[model samples]
Target: MKDFPAQYDLQDEDVLYFPHIPKTAGMTFRTILEDQFHNDDVCPATLNAQLKDYSQADYEKYRLFRGHINYVDIPQILSHKHLLLVTVLREPVARVISHYEYIRRMPGDPHYDMVKDMTLEEFAQGMPVGRLGKNVQTYYIAKLAQFDLNHLSPDEVFDLAKKQLDRLAFVGILERFQDSLFLLSYIFGWKPIINTRRENAAKDKKSKEEIPPSTIELIKQNSLLDIDLYQYAKELFETRFAEMQRDLLTKYGAFTHPQTVKEPMSSQVTQELLERHAEQRFLNLNPDISNSLSYDFVEPLRGTGWHRRESLNDRSGYRWIGPETSATLDFPVASDEDVIIEIKTICNYATTPDVAASLTLDVNGHPVQLEILYSDRGSSVRWFRAIVPKVALDNGRVFSRLTFRVNRVVSFTEVNPLNPDPRVVGIAVNSLKIFPVHAAKTESAALSVFELKSWRDVATFLEKHLGPGDKIAAPLVFQLKLPNEVLDYQTAFLSKVDFQWLILYKGTIENLNPILFNLLIHRFSPVFADGNFVVFTRQKQLPKLSFLALHVRALYEDRIKVPIKLYIIRQLKQIKSLFVRRSKQAETD
Candidate 1:
């Protein structure tokens, strides 16, 4: 493609060349790719004459050079920059049909007048559109090898096309459009600003099934070489896509295990504040602000998997995700900081416990931790909170994808026999909000359950936490079992806390509970104080523990004005038994 080195060479190849073959969804690709660069950085070269307006200097300035330009003409047009080529192809017969329909709809196409009165059959048989009417996808690829198709045999032409197709940066299939965009992001390291709008669709075009079999056959006869080329491209696309998926799944682990979203940011007042402060971060689906956001952050990319926005009672807008296992949102991060993402959704179809739907979120191939902040199964509404740590985000990217995969999808018909709606639904998403988790270093504290592994770790912590006069308030030590991965993100979340953080260890309850209780009181002594306390034990003891009484006492003491939250880890049976025995003994005492 572009006569570059065998390997993808970026030293001189600063430009991305997209050859827009007609009716292959190339315009959509152009729209998305152009968003990755500045407006002036994209060449205005849709035709040979448009190429004359730009000098070599002008070509060098543009990062993306795309248009309905011929493959052979690209090298001379973009002579200054070596190119990385990308294109999309559709099924040959379908593309031919779309081409004819598009010509009939658009008055601007060169063959529009000629094709205005032509029937689908007449267009298929007449083949008046020259190279584009027959095996156009192959025609583009085959031209890369030889300028003159007149010299090559039919098999020779097909073989040449296949060889060049292997060398291009990417070739997307229009049928698998969403997957193609997802793969494009991964392969090119682009955070896609996904626009799902299909530009220039041929309105009122009949479905392929409606076309007569003889007419379809006629189109197929002319597209034989394109069909072969498309098959090869399809197989190649699948192989490459599979390899990408395996690499990602292997690296990120299976999404079968779901971590609940812990900090759901759904309070109307807080949401309003965030919207007022950083309006760009809020994407209100009711108003459909995805397209209006300046940076275009956190918008749904694949339009196929989602139903149109609909209102339910007082809720003005919510969209149902279905038919696909995953729904992807574009997330553009401004820096390498942790981000808080909140989504309001309803899993209505998953009415029964056996059919409960669980969701997992991932960013740039790394899974983030999620916890449910609020849920009312009776109302069928749940608020999900996800903390995408800096480690998972690619800072300063045009956008990173936030992909949500559900464990199962249930159809309305499957849920109830009388229901006629058979669409397999994932979740009904109401709204999505994303903002950076700011680290307010001035107002912060560190409440560690266990001592860090070494002095080096302690030093690292001190370097991150301590300012000029700050002292490590004699390590309020206790032991709690938690995965180090969980510890890392959780503590990062707590690093900038202005409120009290009380850590409880169930194993040494008798020895530590009094001390923790007293500390909790002291921390809550301020007239207006609010905080979060975490219980890290091996079991589900929060419900049965004597410490529950102490926690209740702290709230009733009239010394605290704000709410205190309790976050507990899930329990093991053995730990539960031990905590139960301890509670009984404490009661007896």
Candidate 2:
């Protein structure tokens, strides 16, 4: 099977419908859903209340439907098309205990106070009278056959739940989660989801052994229907899993699990190459950690503006903010202080002379007064500076959003009749930096800056700056022109050195290819600890490091620096000499 772009667009054109029952490892499964489908195609109805306003057209538009929804509760529009129903089931008694813990821990839940004072047994016994009791899984699944849960008998509900399991495209057992993930991947033609972190699990939750036996018995008694349903689901999962394993062997000629499939060596080399390129281009840009937090227009942490990355040349790129746009940058602050925000903007679309664009700046929802730092009409570049008061930043957040509202916007078509570009553009931002007013003054004294223009310059810079224990943590928040050859050589040189590398790239880490990046990270595991190299991204799946050293010889190729190549050769010769000595000693013995 090959990777299907979207499951909805498959030959059968089936919708991937997941009726998520709470506390059944569905949150972890959601990571896969998000990765597999586009955000616009996934339904936002997590609860039934969210689904109340959705019309048939709304229901039909989404390719994937998930969240805390019951199958029967889904709109009738879904019934007209081919549907691939899937769900995960946890062990009944365990599920009940987990749900009870979840409710007690989460103050946001409406039932939080209701079960706060009750003992585990009391909670189970008392709650069993309603729809969301010990048998909630059965309650959700049985409703598929008969929507009216009040009328269905316990036996009838259990039987219907089993029938629903028989009809499901796949049934996942939460205990065998990894196996379930692999099975689903093979079945659905998805890239294998590896190292998914569990989400939404209750804090300080107890194991089955921690609970009193009486409480366990009480939960078991209440969850009789769910226990039976879970057993059936487990059986179904096992049969399907075995069949899938056989199919995988028959198709691919081996047991193809995510753990078994190795990531390519080229991917690792490529990641190092890209990260190095970012580092060399922006090294020594940040004067100090406390000075400023910069948000490049190409990659703001969070914002409202969206179009596409615009590049004037290979050396520089920026994004156009429409009428209004906001860029958020986060930095640590120990005390309250006023900060200066610098915006480098260009208004080439300005129709009026002397007035390129009128921008109103706001910091953390508070209006700020802007001062014209400098304006150059010849280059269409304007530098606007503003001071955000300490009161505005005292909102108990480490980060502040700087919003820009422009008075005028002109499309390319509006600017020129022959121009086919229809993009509505306001002022284009090259850099957005926020720093404490005091730190801005002290930036010149913080660190020695360098402008390494070539491979020799980079080598000299590294030799001068990097010591035995020196940590080269380059925060790429500003733009600097550096040659492409130096970027590659700098990366290769750093790989040969005895220094800590904490290179940070502020842009979208999601834009980088995952397989390559993960492989690169795994390569660093030998020199550093588990978390030494960290790049903040929007994904929750942690990269699993492999122990494979198959790429050692690959690193000895032409890409490596000359000195490093010589060092490797010398090390290899020493290893050979040691072996020869050992052989001679054995002969003497």
Candidate 3:
């Protein structure tokens, strides 16, 4: 008997009812399946004989078979395409406790004496715990032990249940027994039949036998894995049930018993059915358009400035603007014409004396006249804007570079300063806009800008765009250089960027290691000169300058970073002063 592999050998027409937990209801469900489908003249002897054979088998051996069926080892009896596997999941703890009580009360069982006399706590403690072990304790503990025991975590079990449901065709919650039965019947193309047993028949059992609060809490804590599984199942059931109800209502005003006196189909109902058929026909006729018209950001930096240049000098200072910068700007065209160049210096420091300086722009041994458009000095820093016109260039379609020569050196005393790192003054051209006037027709094109949201969003967005098999190239715009830690946490999801940055910065400060955060704040601080001009560059393009100006108000309303808000508000006040000074200066000029 042990060597012989038992086979149900169900035909295509026959329904196979595999119940994991056997009880009177299980038996009755099986009987109903046989009675409803098995026509007397067609195949009466076949099913009867199978039932008798199953009954004659040893109960212990059959129980083992039943246990193995629920596991992954079950033979794939139903073809993958045809099979519609269904299961009913009870609350694990309750199921285990109920099973323990039933087994303990059984007549003449070997473990009956031991279990009957012992408390549940003692029996549970004595059992060899974990998955594949029998329920000797409360249901919750037994479930935990069975799936993970000491090895796997509760979260893992929850994940596993989700995976299992995804792998299988159907799963049903025992709490919604009738609804589950209806779904099962619909899928199998059978008439719905409810099994009447002690549990199902006893409608007031829930009110009568209220589970203890302590037991429920234990179940909730111990079977956290199952709680997640139950929530997911419940959500799926609700969504699908709602859709089913809508379909039924649309087809037949309201769903009624099929056996009841049939109402004549209305003309309106027939028209609705025809309309549905026509819609489906239209859908079938049209080719799916989603695949086309989808736009993706493509890599545009190939053979561009981002490519590594072997001969380029990696100097760390206020280096002279050379051929590389000129090459990037597509500057100084042919026909011996001079080009005008402008430079803007933005500084943020208080108590810094304002200084005046002269700068010269030269192209191919030709001098150009320079003019100061704007100049402001403050306690912290000074901002200067100078423009040079009509620099000479070489003949006929050759690109010539314009170089700036500083004549007078201006120095300022850094006093009452925030003492941001890299006190060494340097110049950064944030952007260059070129307007070409071809005779009377003038055209303008500006460089594309890429703004990072939070450091995290940048990382994740980059990973998805840059990952293998993805064709996205780095944005042609300027890139922000961030710390390695900032990049690490933000590389997976867009939504977590700001949160990750905040958490990392907060953690660093809380742990008394403020060096990194402080360094970042100082380097990225807003630069304002004498409460006149505010100038700053961000790694990402900000959405609205006004929002940044109202930083404090926005932070309270929109809940942005405190440091960021402070910086914006301080900058805005200085910018207002700068606007007033500029208006006065223009009038004098």
Candidate 4:
């Protein structure tokens, strides 16, 4: 295997795709490779299976029968014939998150909820020993340890990744998945799949409540190792990607498609006539004729005002642009009247902060009121919150331009903040929408409803809600909805429809969810009710949610709710006192 690169044009040989196990990267790599070498003189085999299997006499004969064999091995498999040894490495935080998600969805696994009770460190340590399960945690631990990060320091993960690259014809990063796929295809003489979609993509459900910050911090600290690996892999892949692009341009001479004959057919020509003749081709072979244009064809067109052609700028009208109309507002606040304005901010950064927006209100056409409100931020590129005020925007003099300014400065600098420099100050009158607040009748009504039953129920609910024109919120809508007492349980009965909906929404492996976003990752087939829509999960086989519930119970001793404990304790005391009084009255009688 070491000498394989010497005989073959390593650049032209089939790729040895080795995505670290448990990373959805493998699934993507496999799918792309399958598409690329659909009929090439190369055979693809999984490294998940031991090399001993291929070394057997029968395996050798089988390869001889097939005419070509390319074995994909992890950790040590390297050869000159291997055009590329690509592995997608995710951030340690992301990897662990994915691992947790994987374990959560395992069938008949009772220890899944145990993750909630243990620290990430304890979880990582227990992973290698299969405390969760011999089948689930052990496999992930082996895959994670394959890089030898355990023996080396955190910084060494990068070095190990670099060393792995030294053995590879090319290395691809998981972060820039499409770019990596293009690079792999170019390097390995493989045809890229034009429109491959993810195999199993999870649906985006809106969650009203936010996860605790400590949990997020724990995840980050635990996945520090992966973070190192990701940084290294990203840097390596970017460098390689640029080099590969340069090499392709230099070798292929600007990368254009060969010209094709476009003969105009008469409008009267019948469809039957075109299909009847085998020699006649209807569609142009060069679908991307625009991209492959020569300098001669493009240069003259630019000066002739022909740049306005739709093909030249395909993305011209793709975005929404607000109308140029503007509106002005004037407000006067009395000494007793305090004005309040609500603003929403989009947090597109790595760290969530208590961001505050500043406002400049003008009284008598002079700057007067300057106020700020602390806003909670979330981790996604888009974060929104409604600001409620104890006072209204009524001020003095009946009319003055009120300007709202945003303090662009972020609180934390260690991690990337979504909006490093905010543009709008205080509150923009246009952005603010005023609404009167109504007091809730009861505390229970204020809480968001989350019912956890079985995967079946979840799936059914999803199919019904999701349709052609509906929009779902992100950070996921579904909560495990564990019983309050068993907050630590990994396994819980998921509504069947919810499970089915998740499977259908999340497509193939090609479009796997980002590790940070996915809470559960399992392989299963998706079934459709209307015979049109489909749903599936990561599990290959469908297991009953009840069987999985046993594991849920084991992992979480009782379900937990944020306010349930306090409410229940108070109610219990009231019941006890009532019983005591009733007994005293009975004794007196």
Candidate 3 TM-score, C-alpha based: 0.31
lDDT of 1 by residue, 1-589 (tens): 2232322323335788787888888776776776455445567677756776666676677777787767446655555666677889899998999888888887988888999999887887777323657778888877654557776777888888888887888888999887776557556444322344465565476788998899999999888889988998899888776665554444332322223212221233222222222222222212342211222112323223454444456534565665666776654455446766666666554433343446777877788876544344356655556667777765333346677777766777676778776567677776666665553111111112124344224334334433443322122221112112122222423364232223322221122333434544444221111122223222222232333355444533423222222222233556788999999999999
- In model 4, what is the error at residue 89, expressed in angstroms? 2.1
Cα lDDT tens digits for candidate 3, 250-285: 554432333431233333342233233323333344
Model 4 residue 336 distance off true place after TM-score fit, in angstroms: 92
Candidate 2 structure quality by residue, lDDT tens digits, 1-589: 1112212223346678787887888876764564455455667687777888888888877777888767436635577877767788999888878877888787898788888787788878787543455688987876665667677677877887778778777778999887776666555554344422445655477898998898898888888888888888887777666665544444443322434433221222322222222222222343333535665544322334433444454334455655333332234333357777777776454433322456678777899987544344455655667778888777544345566766666666666778876556666766666777776544421112233133234334335434454434232221121211122213333465332433322121111233234335544432211211222212223342233433322222322356556779999999999999999999999
Task: Report per-prediction Cα RMSD to one decimal.
Answer: 18.9, 26.1, 31.4, 27.4
- Compared with the true structure, all predictions reach lDDT values of 0.56, 0.56, 0.33, 0.34
For TM-score, candidate 1 versus 2, the one ahead is 1
Q: What is the lDDT of residue 532 in candidate 2?
A: 15
Deviation from native of the Cα of residue 183 in model 3, angstroms: 1.7
Q: What's the distance in Å from true for residue 478, model 3?
A: 99
Compared with the true structure, what per-residue lDDT tens digits does model 4 show for residues 192-276? 3222334333333212134356655655554554555456556766766555444443443222321321222121121112111
Tell me model 4's lDDT, rounded to 2 decimals. 0.34
Query: Which 10 successive residues of model 2 have the least lDDT summed?
Result: 477-486
What candidate 2 gets wrong by more than 4 Å, as runs, is 1-9, 254-589
Model 2: how large is the Cα RMSD against the reference?
26.1
By summed lDDT, which 10 consecutive residues of candidate 3 come out lowest? Answer: 294-303
